[model samples]
Target chain A: MRALSGKVAIVGVAESDQIGRVPDKPAIMLHAEAARSALAEAGLTKDDVDGLFTAGISTTELGEYLGIQPKVTDNTSVGGSSFVIHVGHAATAIATGRCQVALVTHGESGRSRVGMPPRVTPPDSLRGQFEAPFGLPQPVGAYALACSRHMYEFGTTKEQLAEIAVATRKWAMLNPKAYLRDPITIEDVLNSRPICWPFNLLDCCLVTDAGGAFVMTSLERARDLRQHPIVVLGFGESHTHAMISQMPSYTSFAARQSGKVAFEMAGVTHDEIDLAMIYDSFTYTVLLSLEELGFCGKGEGGAFVSGQRTAPGGAFPMNTNGGGLSYTHPGMYGVFAVIEAVRQLRHDYLDQGIRQVPDASIALVHGTGGVLSSAGTAILARY
Target chain B: MSGYKKPLPKPDPVTAPFWESLKKHAMKIQRCNDTGKFFFYPRGLSPFTLSDNISWESVSGRGVVHAFTIVYQNRDPAFAEDVPYVVAIVELEEGVRLMSNLVGVEPDPGHVWIGMPVEIVYDDVTEEITLPRFRPVRAT
Candidate 1:
């Protein structure tokens, strides 16, 4: 099988004009605003975009709103990890000469709810028939259920999970755009109101308004773009059950399958990864991703994240942009994960201090979606 | 009664049998005829073999608490009044797992523990709907 490694490069990355709490702008406007800025950063125009990729929203509607007639389009909506998987799909399309310039964008009023469709689980659906009737309180309850099992099987502690929140909050303090900037400690997290058992209010991600986007093209054409091209080195995507009840094992996740393929295709060792952008819809998400991604041994995520190892200035730098826990998590957060990795690789915050991972050459960005159901991992490089 | 605000199971053709079984105070899950592996959330085909050779077999209404959580805040009107309830994943004696609520005990960490034995009890909420819930099993 031929590898898509080095075949595509991301040239531009940007967020909507305003990230947190823009109640006036609807989701589609956010998409247009981000696309405009991303295209300008790449020194390209809307006419130059031939491939449009988005999720959670209609592709045809976004295409008409953006005034772009793309030759190819993808509406692969697999929850939060949709955009990360789109990155891999775009690379494949470009490598096969299906399209030249691909635009991946995201916009959601997760908090404001303006122009957002009503969230529904129909009575006839599988979830409606089986899981929804139990009043699990979605996403959180599902995550909490898995966390309970993690604690049972591995003896993981709530204090250890608090360490992840503390570390990510530290990074959030450095980013001006992060939603929750105040510094918090383990005790503060532990003391926070309990939303669901095993998950305190502080452990949950903020629901805010935001939009993010990035532009990519063939590697040969990327060198001439406005910004340094960040190559799509290796990528992998996988999904397990949609319902938390049907999950094969609550303690393990599909990231193991996705991460292995990503690492193998990238041909890089664990130590070579300079930064990791694991989606943090919840603190346990990070700990589980760390273990499943081979950063640490299974049943050791609690110990691995102890003492703020993943915090800034620690042994490993992760979620430098605060992550969904502290930063803006507008429903789907995969695009923001890629946006942060691109910014770090380009040294966007080098002079600003603290948030940038010094000389960041390779980054592993992973996104978990749908109650820890789907995972998409991408290995990006700045060679 | 019109006052039961909680969400109820909406069964269709593929899943009507499971709900009908619950109305009779019994539990039946889809089992693959070939592999003898049982599956929950009844479906037409076997998840293991993807064959139409499936049967709705009666299963013991007994299981163990695989995992659980006590929800304190739920904004949905149907569930807001029922805060601090026990929502759990029960692994049945037949080896299939399903999400349900645990009753007959306080919704507290001290009262609930993983691997605790549980048995099913039917709640005939509406004329047409009967919800299946679990409770701690007493030692024989």
Candidate 2:
């Protein structure tokens, strides 16, 4: 179970110099800027990177922009969680000596639309044929469908969902770089305009332009790097169905499969996790993921997250960098989640006046992608 | 059908029969010949057995709304006019589910509920294309 555990460590992590609507920086430029920054932080040059991983953008494009020739490349674009899944892949490559140093990156101009190509789904595709014809505004509609079912089955209420947005915003206020820093309340979320039934506009993540990158190397080499190594103790990924309609169950997620593998490999229990960075594509994403990740019993997430349990000064500190809800969410937000986890574990923000989880030694980062179709869970530790 | 801006399904060979059956106002689902299990969103091979032992069979279009959402914002030019529409996933009595739109009822919280009985209704939006939607199964 611990084959790759502690064998690899994330040596450096950084976000693009500019995020949250940089109209001038194209998507590829964000990738380049983040890659450069992360490499520099690791005390390594682009030449030392033997593996390149990216999503939404191709490895070829990223490598050319960074002028690095990687011996191995992975463009596993499962959706937003693609970056988190890449960390698992990078760990495997490093463990097998397929590559010594792996660089995982993400860049998306989700809001500014700079250098972003037009998105087109062929009419003959599965989504085009089965799901797209009903005028369902994707993503939100898809997530709302699951939320509706959760409410029906588990009595999850708008109030319970609002608690998530409220808690996430609290964290956003503590970070200077967050896109929406103003505090929000449960009432504020419930009163926000409805985009899809059961999903108010406030419950959704921000649409912004951002890029993030991180470097991974063998644990032995990581100890010599510039930063404290956040060891990859366990990692697992799973995919069920791409189309939301085909999701095995509306109340549960594929994360159940992924999280089980990760926790078992890491040999850690829920009580030992010091912090969590769960994907917040929507409020329900967090609620359901908590349940599926075994943080709480099934159908109990609403009650579990009530009273801002995940907010600052609460029992469980999560998404301290604000998360996709208030932080920068380029088309995919997984890389940023990993970056925040590393910072907290390394105590990088201790003097920055930001709220880093005190003495956070173990962290659980879970990423969801493609309408909850894919999940990737990673357990990281500072020891 | 002029100015019909909504998105349309483009059927391939494997899914053409499902679309063709809708054109005839008779919905057909794929069933595994070996397992005798019906599946929606037709495919050539059985998902259970991964074999081509599959057959198309007609079934009662009666179902229930398993879940639904009233979409208020969709920026697609094809669907802009249909804002505040009801998009749902209906589970058929045969135990298969598919995505559709609810019609003949208001797209409001007061109207739609999970497990509400529904039946399929075909809409011939174009001369060659037909969409299968759903509506409440009225009490007899």
- Could you report the DockQ of all the candidates, in the order they appear? 0.84, 0.89
Model 1: CA > 4 A from native: none
Q: In candidate 2, what are the lDDT values of residues A323-377, reduced to their tens digit?
A: 9999888778999999999999999878855387888999999999999899999
The C-alpha lDDT values of all candidates are 0.92, 0.92
Q: In candidate 2, how many Å is residue B96 off? A: 0.9
Count residue pairs with overlapping backbones in model 1. 0
Candidate no. 1 TM-score: 0.99
Task: Work out how many backbone clashes candidate 2 has.
Answer: 0
Error of 1 at A369 (Å): 0.7
Per-residue lDDT for A303 in model 2? 99
> After TM-score superposition, what is the CA distance of residue A331 in candidate 1 from its true location, in Å?
1.0
